[model samples]
Target: MTMSLGPYASFIVTSYAAAAIVVAILIGWVVLDYRNQARRLRELDRSGVTRRSGRSAVDTP
Candidate 1:
């Protein structure tokens, strides 16, 4: 089946295409960032580094 966009076809089609591309780019960036962060955390862990929090486990008690 053939789909047709009436008078504002170009505008509508271009808008949808642009939106799709933007969403794809955003998803790719998030995945890349997550991988990089995970790798950095692993390296830090290997070097015996620990994360500190303002509220300590001992303080909680």
Candidate 2:
């Protein structure tokens, strides 16, 4: 079986590929940022720095 994209096959395929690449990059960036932030919070906690509520930075509730 085969599918056709008419006269704009290359354009359509390129657009989809570009979108996928952008989404992948964004996801990677978010994951790295989250890890970096968590590490920073841990360091702060070790140094006795904490929230104004006197709770650990890594703590939830």
The Cα local distance difference test for each model comes to 0.94, 0.94
lDDT (Cα, tens digit) per residue for candidate 2, span 14-53: 9999999999999999999999999999999999996878
| lDDT tens digits by residue: candidate 1, 1-61 | 9888899999999999999999999999999999999999999999998787756888776
The pairs that clash in candidate 2 are: none
lDDT of prediction 2? 0.94
Which residue segments of model 1 deviate by more than 4 Å? 1-3, 54-61
Using TM-score, give the best candidate's number: 2
TM-score to true structure, per model: 0.81, 0.82
Please report the TM-score between candidate 2 and the true structure: 0.82
Q: Which 10-residue span in candidate 2 carries the lowest summed lDDT?
A: 52-61
